[model samples]
Target: MNVLSRLWTIAAERRNELVSGVSRKTNAVEAVEDLAAQLKDVDAAVVLIFASPHFDKDKLADALTQNFGATPVIGCTTAGEITPLGYETGTLTGVAFPRLHFRFSSRLITNLSRFSIDDGLRFCREFVSDFGETPGWNSLAILLTDGMCRQEEALLSAMEPGLAPIPILGGSAGDGLDFKQTFVLHEGKFHSDAALLTLLATNFRFTELRFDHFLPTEQRMVVTDADPGRRLVREINAEPAAVEYARAVGCSVDELSPFVFATRPTLVRVGGKYHVRAIQKVEPDDGLSFLCAIDEGLVMTVGQAQDIVAHLDREFTGLKAKHGQPTLVLGFDCMLRRLESELLKKYNAVSELLRQNRVIGFSTYGEQYHGMHVNQTFVGVAFFDPENEEETGGEREK
Candidate 1:
């Protein structure tokens, strides 16, 4: 007998304020392990894991790999992780699933440098096409890349011209260890300098995402001098690159540092509209660099239109209206965005809302949408029936 999403069971726990403004949690494994222990027993899945700076890569990977070996894991390092139990600080929180009825597929490219745009479009087209064949299928792309890679825009650009109107979402991955390296986990392996793409298909209806959180607050600056990647190693809008960036965020070059670059990144408008190509690093010669493709002559502005909180509130409210309370939430929140959130006064209120809502996701360096990588964004999918049936909030249990 089909279960009407049936005989539902749940597993959830939270440890609040553990470390680095992070919280930890694990379900299925902790509470529902007895029910969903066999990987083959499950149909659809979700996972949440956290690693602290206190632990090194090997230990963190080994521990997580031990508990969540069979699941296709997609998450980024975070200042903290949120769960129904509360927030987990400086801990590795993991949740697993072995029984659920739905559809999902995950694929990865080991090295994007060798992978071409053709390969990307082919993958997205193929994945989405397959999901379309499923009954009641709604699609989303959960993409993760080595945060250091600056290929998101080019990659998305390459795929867009050919694919149907597919809205991609997900984030750049990070190693909980540091901002320097990011990783993705699949089949018990922790990948460094790689990208993971998860295509989800469920009967659940979703939201129509419009990019916001930033506006052209300042005049566009032309990058007169630059390198091959189009980095402005000399000036922006006719001023030292550092000056424009520091000026926008309200700081001084002497006081400006790499840490500043991470938390307060700038965006360059590419291909007519402003795509989120954030300044990933600053040069010693006083130039700025990016994590995605940028070309000289590209006019960039210190972007500032809306705060993320306002943008997100609008997005979430829209989702709630479209599908009511979500059945499942898979969030890719940028790690840098998490830091900016902490610096902002509303961080506590924001995390609490997610906690109360029972959202399970990891912090990322950047995010993925449809089939492309993006930064300073929150990419997610909320499950619900289009008709607003019985409002089965219990499916969110474990």
Candidate 2:
């Protein structure tokens, strides 16, 4: 495969001044400086930065605002970053939208645990008020929420109905698998226990992307008992959740670990398509906790794996054919998919696909697409140029 792995490491500055870059510099200031240098010429309206959780976010936020200067900046900590250089840790990746291309506005939702459907409606109203009169242009919302908050489904469900036809895509923030804390940047500061929403009105042609390679098996489990607030399922078909799940997957109860849960995720059908509702972990009482919301009476099927590479190859090829070769794809891939890919020994193949497709993003704690907060799926925005078919700037590493 002709994979240009380190493409994001080389600052890409097109004639239109749309730039995206990744830096592995450990020093917060140095990393921000390097990213800022690539975007210096453009009047940046939106600067999305994803960084390692180890860096002091306060200091990093300071460095970013100092360089970008009050531009509507938003991003979050990540488990692992996806750059043009493939999967990486302890690095910062960013994309800057030049003023000519995008207009940015933001709203921060505080106390997500207390957030409700009403809050979603309110946020939508505020968004409309702030970015009034977005006509003849496409608008997309970028959401960065605390991955540990456990309220993604509710939040997205609430806000989505009101913001009709404006597609939303995002990832939950992570703390490098620690799961202790996560932060989102808004108005040049990092906030925990909150979600940052940014609305972008852009002139660029782009397509929303999401795909998974799991087929539903006949084995089904009904959620007989669950705590929707905590996303814990205590019973499946009136049996202990873990035990029943293991039985369905053809494994012993003792084998129910994070790795096993990741590999043997369950799926729920929505609109005739199966979406993964991945198991997060096994609880002390033998309950199973899920990455997204779970409720009683939900029918979930034991998902069987297919060729991950084959599925992705088709999705990417079809996207390129429909969109005529993307300039880039800002991807939000579910972490469980990464685990499943690694377990299936297809991690490198998946990475090469991402590199070849010019995907720059991170493995999310969860993925948001439209109204659904799904798991084990890859969601992204594929950017296309209406003016030219020639490939734009970005150093190619063979």
Candidate 3:
């Protein structure tokens, strides 16, 4: 290729790169406008947004549709936002995937309360049929669900078989700490009892990442009485659930709050791996309400907090060493982790590390990985440059 021609190609590639932007504007239209202006230069195939629950959902949806024109858009309300500048609140953040390296297809599942495993399987099968495949490109699926739907476990389990070999990962939408309504956006509208699933094909080297800074301790308790449907534990070790948990954590029942739950999470072992079954709040009946499923006669252990900053640094460093610095890290961090960080006074340090590592997304009510709906964990996908001939060849073979 001639020197001038090569220069032109490089410039074109740079303009079509993956891009992210953030806007703290409180008005929905202004926030959308700000984000649209920042992304106007790229030929975006799709744009994913993460906005605070405080915004007017209807106005935000309309503005997004009007500003982005024909580009597809999808996202959800967040407990908090992880922008390029790091952790933020009351803001709208987004990432634009350029058409030069990516393609997308989306499906919206509504009425989650009645969604069954069979329904999820059929839904995924149809989605995959429509998505088809692209040779020499890697594929991944992202699932965003209404956090309050309480159906993530069943939905994820069902979708797993159909999306096998595609590596699905995602998070449940949050309404901050209110634990009230949560919505997922699709087709220029926000629906509370719905989920948005997207399949993305990218000509970029990428990897899935999942981690949490907690270790299962020996302290154990048994759920002797529970309401599985509502995820309520009325009794533990045959005693009042909240009282027993407080005793286990060396605190009083009255002092049991979100921060305490964040610092001392409950874990369950599945497939030889411990996953956090986070507590949402203490119920009026003194039962312990959970963010995930609970069952009678289930054994649970308390988890001890580790050094989050150190653990995060190690994980990000290892990612860089293996992938040679990702262009962007699409992250789904659990809100409990954020609460724990604030309690430990390590929020700034963690935010700085996120900024340095190019992480962007939102703090979720829960996270999904490999068909499991988990809590108190950070789940993400890291996208690296595909320019290296060796790396491109390696990805194609996979």
RMSD of each: 6.8, 5.8, 2.4
lDDT string for model 3 (1-398, tens) is 99999998876765678999999999999999999998887789999999999999999999999999999989999999999999999999999998878889998998898998887898898888889887778889999999998898888888889888788899999999898999999999999899899999988888899999889998999999998889999999999999999999999998998788998989999899999999998999889999998999899999998899999999999888877888899999999888988988999999999999999999999999978999999999998878763432225222
Candidate 2 stretches with Cα past 4 Å from truth are 1-15, 388-398
Give residue 8's lDDT in candidate 3 (0 to 100): 87
Candidate scoring better on TM-score of 1 and 2: 2
Model 2 lDDT tens row, 167-188: 7889999888788999998888
Clash pairs, candidate 2, are 5-84
lDDT by residue (tens digit), candidate 1, 128-167: 6665645444455556666656566556665554345545
TM-score of 1: 0.73
Model 3, position 231, has a per-residue lDDT of: 90
Clashing pairs in 3: none
Computed on alpha carbons, the lDDT of every model, listed in order, comes to 0.55, 0.83, 0.91
Which order, best to worst by TM-score?
3, 2, 1
Q: Score residue 22 of candidate 2 by CA lDDT.
A: 87
Clash numbers, per candidate = 36, 1, 0
lDDT of 2: 0.83
